[model samples]
Target: MLNRFLLPALAATLLTTACTEPPKTVAALPILGERDVRPRADGGPADTVYAAVPAFRLTDQAGQPVSNQTFAGRAYVTDFFFATCPGICPKMQSELLKVYKKFPTDPRISFLSITIDPDHDSTAVLRDYAQRLGIGDASRWHFASLGDRAKSFELANHLLTGVVPDSLAPGGLAHNGTLALVDDRGYIRGAYDGLNAGQVAALQRDIPVLLAEIDGRKKGVAKK
Candidate 1:
């Protein structure tokens, strides 16, 4: 009869609808680097801890000592730039400002702009630069110095982003034009080209995803 045929078709449509629903958002961001690996006691395979930015101490624009601990429970965007750069640094900052404006006053997020030219960008210089940029909130944004030239280069080239001294370069130093997104746990979640509007927008999108992932984990633990 028509009732029997219609019932089966309705069931089929319902099944199809159930199957087509989008899956839940899962945070599966790949951990960068393979060095933080260890062998399992059961001898199955080595486990990777996922590379994390090592602890560092630096002086912020306010002449205050800040370290990795400063961002212990906050997600942050980081980039390397000197105050007087005549090239892409300005563009990078302009893009980063968009991200900042999007999350302004959100204590869960912060920004770090570390200077590669620390010798010339002293605390006073950084403070002045920050002021000019309208960065009135020191807690949310920091312009810092690594203090040591070799350490600065090491951090720029190895830890956060790429940087190299070049006499022929526009700013006396060549550096990556990307911004690094670090999760609350100190792991680098993602990197976006700070000079590209599209990539910067992607960075903004990923920030909430990372924050949601952290929130989900916390709720899971609480339910246990």
Candidate 2:
């Protein structure tokens, strides 16, 4: 799993190594990922396409289908975790709970927790887990899995939170506590340290900025 700091480093790689610096603004968060330059159909400037998350099919706690379409027109916070995790999972989820409470009923927001130990965290188990966490709304918060360990890990990597098996690790798995924020367009807008309260607070602040950006786009208003 990649450390939280690695996200900023990955974003900074696009910058020149010279003394020059890009102007910083709070109105819009930077999109983080590899990109491609392509010719525009309008024959205008070439478009730079950031890597968007690929579509995936998952089963939620309620045994309902969950995919990118489930979050259409909404922004979501996602993390990788197993129900039996003995290390950072509890604290990470606790921090995420804070963000969830802030927008528990907001139709524009959602949460996703992808389990790497699907064999042990079946839909019934995940349903019990979400109930234990007091997350009663499956529509607002989804505890989902790909139903295969390898497939789950592969999907985690696609979401930028890599997961792997490790005999020495807690619960026989090694993964980071990264809370990834994805906008409605399926582009990653932010990544936070799930174990750090300050970073989580930063995530809380950034969510509204992202939501505002989404609203601006809907109204044909340019984002700052």
Give the number of the best model, judged by TM-score.
1
Off by over 4 Å in 2: 1-26, 39-44, 221-224
lDDT at position 90, candidate 2: 97
Which candidate gets the maximum lDDT versus the true structure? 2
- TM-score of candidate 1 versus the correct structure, residues matched by position: 0.88
lDDT of 1 by residue, 1-224 (tens): 89999999999999999989698767666555435668899999888777678888999999988899999867888899999999899999989998999999988889999999988999999999999998997778999998998798777654557788899999788888869888878888888889889999999888898887777777887999
* Poorly placed runs, candidate 1 (over 4 Å): 1-21, 221-224
Q: TM-score of every model?
A: 0.88, 0.84
Relative to the true structure, candidate 2 reaches a TM of 0.84
Candidate 2 clashes between residue pairs 3 or more apart in a chain or in different chains: none
lDDT of each: 0.85, 0.91
For candidate 2, the lDDT comes to 0.91
User: Residues 1-224, candidate 2, lDDT per residue (tens digit)?
Assistant: 57688887866875645547667665879998779999998999999989998888999999999999999878999999999999889999999999999999988889999999989999999999999999999999999998889988887887778687889998899999999999999999999999999999999999999998888777774433
